[model samples]
Target: MSAELRDRFFALSTGGAPADEVARYLAEVDAVDTEPAATLDGLGISWHPTVRFKAVRFVDAERIDADVRELFARPSQEAPYLAAVFVDPRELSFRTFENIVPLDRLLADTPLDLDLTRRAELAEGAYSFSLRLPAAARGHLERLDALNLYVPPLNSGSRGGERFIFHSAQLAEALTKAVAKALPQPLRDGFSHVNPVFRCNRFEPGDANFHRHRDTPYYDAERHHVSRYTLLLYLTGGSATPALDLTGGVALAEIEPFTCVIFDQRYEHEGAPYDDGRKVFLRTELIFTFTESEVTHDPEIGALFGKACYWTGESVFAPELARHADAYYNQVAAAHWSALTPGADREPFVHKQFRGVHFVANGYDFWFAKSDKLSLAECAAITLLDYFNCKLGDTSFRALCQSEVIEADEADAAAWIPGFLQDKRGDSAVPPIDKSLLFPEPEEANNECCPFHSWAAFDATRSEDVIELYTQAQTFAKAHILPAPIVMLGEDVLLDPDKFVIRGNSIHVLGKESLTPVNFAACWNAGGLPGNYIDIAATVDTAHFLVPPIFFTESDDCYHLRFDFFRNSWMVKHQQVTIPVPMVQDGVCDDGDPYPWRYAVDEVSLFTDNASDRGKADLWWVDNPAVEDEMRDVFD
Candidate 1:
């Protein structure tokens, strides 16, 4: 009620006005108290009176949600925040909706505490002095302008038997609608539909490190091309949080207060932890659907979906033999898989299985059994491949293409694979890689040379077996590496095997320092290792996904925006699309220094792109739609 109006009620009733006049005053409260909201236009204000208490709330919960979603979708130059305040339960007198007899006595029986003594006083020497309640809410006075309250029952403010209250019926109706969603009807017999309830979520400390993962939990991969928005609500402040920017992600919208962050969900993300305590929020989800009836209409969309279907697949791997073929393979070595336009000439692959294949194929797996000399070489190869995939997906590669995108030039890209990839930097006359080189430094540092690359290395006995996979991979790579309009590759070089480790199966022999991979991928193009090619955290693990490639602003930063899949990473560069990724040192290279070819990027556990397993066999299966036909055809 308006303060002006509320004053009137207390004015007449406080000191006990005459009995006859009391009836007149009660009637006044009734009229305003039971008032109905005018319309949706009056959404900002509302009140509803049950028998004894007035239930109040904002009438436009729906409006607020929509607006927040819109705001979240906007990209902002400022750090965003979204905050909400909930009345602390310990402070509120929730007598209208819950069983409160026990609580009432607890307060009544308590000795006068400093905070409440002033408000709770009993008249001296009276037969039964009336008890006054203390103010029971935080930030209550400041928001009284937008407040709702419930008053107690008649004559003596007693309990039970009474089953009603009065207020703006609009308030009552709104709560009914909001709470109704959390409950199902017919299953309940009473006014639960009328009672108001809200879920409480609190943030607590979670796992330590961040996990980079890409997923579409709400929609089917094939049917939905994009989701419009994501809303994350905060209930309280705390230290731990799970949210991060990963490669291949861009803000189609934004993040901020009372804001709804709407972005292209394809951008991979990570759930990072905040050191400070931040509370968990009540989360709401919404999706804009097309064609409501059975979700069917045209066949063209079916084809588009089929082409883009890799969005749902789990990434797999080919042997590492091809990954170490110098710089070209180094890039893809870190990726899950390479995304390529089907057929020659960058065709969109009108076939269902080809669309978006690169991203789906990008984030894959390669592991080292034990640390040893052979494993390091194998890891170098496999890791480089994954990296190549990530590099292609990143902004670094996008900036390289001229005319620019390789997605349009399949032939040069495919043909350039071997020689350019093997050892592009052996020549000394080549220029050092330019920050603006866009493409990996040497044209020759591409996918050609096939060192003993494999997480498991060349088990002398299995050498022949590994060779076949390498040959196939090289062939597969040649088909997709496009002819230039300036082809820039987005890829990562994963060091998943125990590179140079002194222990077990992955012993990376600290042998003759070989900058072969670096020379091939970067310098080969420029004809020499770039003065400052980046080094990312190329990890290796045996049991957990051996190596997961994620590009970062700083080579060691795993929390930056990452591309969890190869397809998306490949598409971004190959297609030459602009997206946000951090920019590191961009000036002249660190003065003609050799690339840091051998470095220790710890074994990290990546929040793999794809879906979270809710506990099933295989955790992932080759048959998953994202892979299946697409892999079969590509591998063939």
Candidate 2:
């Protein structure tokens, strides 16, 4: 009987059973089971013994249906949607029940600054302050890696009083595991992780109350995850009123401390103003990713191709390219062409073999000879015609060539006809082609080579050949194509000479300059004095200094230069060794003055000794001679 109950409990816990059903079943298990706590713990339920699960169904059917339809329309597979679930706290019937850890104990060592001056002001009269804490505070929770605490900048309609937001990976993981235990098998399988960032709202009596508003879905690009539901963990209790007042006369009034309310983000809800006492609650999001198997079943080739193209220019491309490359290639190669779809316009194709050829036209235009110019597109089309003819060995190629879409220019068509006809007829007497006639060297002014030029020369017969061509194209691009020049600013100021007059004491930035990783590394290893710039010198008024090479790291949002002097030895000894990039924020340095005017610095100006020195004029020894002697004594 006990074994049967265990199986049923496990089935209900993981099988996406309704919360009410699971809750009722837990009661039954508790009544009959000898070790109910052990059984529940073994199944991954981490809630306190006093907590009882309850489903809070909203009355707004229209809104719920709309949300469901929207989720269904998403390209990725959808997870189960629960309108709301109320985790009610009940008096413990059993003896020696384990109690939840006190919130004060959990936040004992955490430093709190209640100053609202520096905090970001929100809608209504609400304001907040935040702090970042290590995950170690919540001991035993392995998934909580880091915590970021801040008050959320709520949307216009929503308003709340002073709230401290806690974004903790540990809390997210703990909640995720607990939630997963109650989810159906399909949803459990699709569950990725809970959003680490959760809002901790503290609304005192007479504080700004939240107005009715729908939550916008939170998207995490880094995780490729989205929040479908909002989880509210009520931290403080004693109020008779429900914390959340929803649309359509429904109210979630379970004001018991530790009672969690999980609801869909689509629900229009508001925190009703309470004058009786304070209300504190933790609000977090349940995040999930689309299953790979589902996404792969009917992949969106166009979107994937677009993403792949964007990734090509990004610093981090390898992982992203690898993800979509195979799937995109497979879809495109297997696609059959009958007619051109709407929005079929001339654009560069992602694939190398199809470069220059109209990607849209390739879908419906069966004919090889369409355009008049003997350009790269024409060459590629002709090559494709020959490849298909050779591979299939039939009249199909000829039939396609004579299709209704064929709009050949008689003069241009005649140029490649002889060689094409010779190949088709298996004729050996085809003369050695004058390569210059077909592909003349472009003028020096227009000599910018396409990264995929090499691939155009080689005919791709199979997917492997296409892959090899892509590899070659990447190699060519890395070798020949220089990325857009990184603009290194001297300080926070713009360095356009036309916009800002070049002053006598200011550093004059020339045009943009590109720095390869090799150049940057060499400069850093050689202690800011690269071999190429040994003879170069820059002068500011009467002072002269060797131009320091600038280095920076790139992220998804912005670029940053490390300002740590210990990492760069030259910076320690020379006051002039500094890359004056824009400061991320306005701040007063130790000297009790605002930062200097930021300006752009050109690499050539620095290397050619044209850039002015704007650093401190006094020597380090003059300011701190005793420190120099102490450093020498320590070293000696």
Who wins the TM-score comparison? 2
Local distance difference test, per candidate?
Answer: 0.25, 0.31
lDDT of 1 by residue, 171-257 (tens): 223323433342224312232222112122232345333234333323333443222223233323333232435355431112222
Off by over 4 Å in 1: 1-413, 422-636
Which digits, one per residue and each the tens of the lDDT, describe model 2 over residues 386-458? 2222111111122223221222332343343233322222111111222112112221222323224533432
TM-score of 2: 0.30
> In model 2, where is the ten-residue run with the lowest total lDDT?
536-545
Assess every candidate by TM-score: 0.19, 0.30
lDDT of candidate 2? Answer: 0.31
For candidate 1, the per-residue lDDT at 268 reads 44
lDDT (C-alpha) at residue 636 in model 1: 65
